[model samples]
Target: MEQGLALLLALSLGLLQPGHGQPLHVEPPEPEVAMAVGASLQFTCSLACAGGAARVRWRGLDIGLGAVLSEAGSSVLSVHNASLSATGTRVCEGSCGDRRFQRTVKLLVYAFPDQLAVSPATLVPGRNQEVACTAHSVSPTDTLSFSLLLGNRELEGVQALGREEKEEDLQETEDLLFRVTQRWLLPPLGTPAPPTLHCQATMRLPGLELSHRRALPVLHSQTSLERPDPTSSEPPTTTSPQATPQQGSTGTPRTDSSTRTCRPEIHWSLEPVSWELLCEAACGPGMTVHWTLAPGGLAAYKRREAGAQAWLSLPPDGSRTEGFFQCRLDPGGQVVSLYVPIQKVIPKT
Candidate 1:
C-alpha cells in the first residue's frame, strides 16, 4: 500500500510540473460594452508557446466591415465604419496541441455622427463668422468630445457653443432639433497670409478613436495702392517694381496686368440669341481669347465678341434651367471664371 501511494504522488507531481520554459499563450483583450459609430475596435491576441509551431485565430462574428488587421505570431481584429448593427460577439481563439485559450468581447454598436459641414458665411478680415460644427450620433454623450484642430493648434473654438439640446412637450410627441456652432475670426489680411482654416471632430469611445476633418480655403481681397506720392516734385527716384506676390502670400496687388494682354470678352446667349453680360478674362500678355462655353449647369451658352467658340451643356438632370455657367479662358486658361448665372429655361418636368 505504501509503494502504491508513493507511485501515485510521483505521477501527480510529474503531471503538474511547470511548462518547462515554454512560451505562454494568451487570449485577446475584448471591450466590455458596445462600440459607438465612427469609432473603431481592435482585438489583440498573442501566442507564446515553446517549440516549433503555434497558431492564433481572431474573428468578429456578424460585424460588417470587420477586418483582420494582422495575422502572424500575433493577431489583431479591427472594425471600422461601425454602425448600430455592427455590434455582436467577437471571439479570439488560440490553440497549440491540447493547450488552448480563448476570449470573448460583447459589442454594442451605437449611432455615429451624421451631418458634417462648414458654415457658408463669407469670412471677412477682422470679422467673426460662426462656423457651424456638429455631429449627429447616437453614442452616449459622455463618451465623445467634438474638437476643432488646425495644424498643431487645437481650438475648442472662440467660445463653447455648447451641445444642442431638445425640449419635449408635455405630451412627449413633437419634432426635435439640435445644433452646435462655434465662431472663428479671420486674421487681418497681410503679406504671407495665415494658414487655411479647418474644423475636425473626434469621437472617443471605448476601444475606438475616430476623427474627421474638413478644410476651408482662406479667402481675402487685395487692396490696390497708387504709385506712392505721385504729386511729389521729386523726379521720382527710380524704384524697382516690387515682385508680384503669389497666392497665399501676404498683402499683394489683386490684379497684376503690366505685360499681360487684355482680351475683350464676349458674353452672349445662343439659346436666346442675346448678349447677357460682357466680361473680359485676362489672357497672359499676348494670348488672345480662344473659346468660351457655358459650362455644366449653365442655362445659356454665349459666344465671345471676337468670333470665339460658344457652346452650352446640360447639368446632371435633363432640365432646361437657368443658373451659373463656368467660362474657361485660354494658354491653358487654367484659372476658370466663377459661375455666371444665365437667364434661360430649357424646361423642367
Candidate 2:
C-alpha cells in the first residue's frame, strides 16, 4: 500500500511539470541594420535551436514602409537605394511546440551628399565684376540657393546661371551654376583698401547637405601725379603749362641733370639711315645704338646697353622706315638733357 502511494505521487509530479520532461527552446532573432542615402542595405536573421516544425516571423520597429523578404526558417532582407527613414531595428520570431523564440538587431541609415562645394573663394570690388560658385553633379531633384558672405553679414542678389541633369546608363548626375555682378558703388580711388568678396552655393535636399564657395579681390584705378617737363631741370609745380614756361631764359631752367635742352634745338632727321649717322646725346661716347625690328618692320631701339658709344642698326628685312624718334643727352654718368621728339627726316633731294 505504501509503494502504491509512492508510485501515485511520482505520476502526479510528472503531470504537474509537463515541459521538464523535454528540452525547452527559446528563439531570439538577431537584428540587422544599414545605410539608405546612397547605397543598398541588407538584413540577416540567425536561428539557434531548430525544431522539425519551427517557423520564423519578421517585422520592423519604426520602419514606415518595407516588405518581408523571406519568412521561411531563416530571414534575409535587401533594401535598394535606401534613405534616412529606413533607420531602426528589426525582430524575428520562431515558434514550435507551444514555445516562442525571438531575435533583434539595430538599423542605421546614412545620408549621401547630393552637392558639394567650398567657402567664399572670390571677391569682386568693382560694380561690373562677377562672382560665381561652381558645383558639379548635384541632385536635380533638390533646389540650390546661393549668397555672399561679407565678414559676418549675409548678402543676396545672386542668379542661377544654369542647371543640368544627365543619366549615364547606370547612374544620374547634376550640376548647378550661380553668379552675381557687383553693383554697389565702388569706394573712391583713395577709400580704405577694399576687402575680398566671398560667395557660397547651397543645395536644399531633404536628406542631404552640401555647399560651395568662392572669393574674389576688389580693385580700383589709382590717380597719378603730373610729371614736370622732362626738358626743364625743375620738377613741374602744377599740371598747367603756364606754371612751366617754354620761353625766356628763366622760363624753364634746363637743369644739368638731363642732356635735354629746355629750348628746342635743330630738328634732327628721323630717317633710319640718318639715325645711324647722328649721335644720340643720351648714349655714352662710342656706345652703339642697337635698333630692334618690330612686327611692323620699323627700326626701333631695342634697348640701350651701356657701352663705349650708342649706335643704330638697320632691320634685316630692309624695311627700315622712319616716323618719329626720341633722343636724350648725357654728360658722363649725369643726364645733361631730356628726351625730345624729332619729326620726319627724308633723304636729301
Best by lDDT: 1
Candidate 1, which segments miss by more than 4 Å at Cα? 1-27, 32-84, 90-103, 108-117, 134-144, 160-194, 223-331, 334-349
Clash tally, candidates in order: 13, 46
TM per candidate comes to 0.37, 0.29
Residues 108-181 of candidate 2 have per-residue lDDT tens digits of 55432433332111222333323334444333334555565655467444444444333323243222222222
lDDT of 1 by residue, 39-150 (tens): 7766666776676465777677643344775455577777776655566777666656555556666776654454454542122345444445554433444444555554
The alpha-carbon deviation from the true structure for residue 152 of candidate 2, after best TM-score superposition, in angstroms, is 5.2
lDDT of 1 at 18: 26
Candidate 1 C-alpha error for residue 37, in Å:
9.8
- Weakest 10 consecutive residues of candidate 1 by summed lDDT: 223-232
- Score residue 267 of candidate 2 by CA lDDT: 23
| Per-residue error (Å), model 2, residue 10 | 51
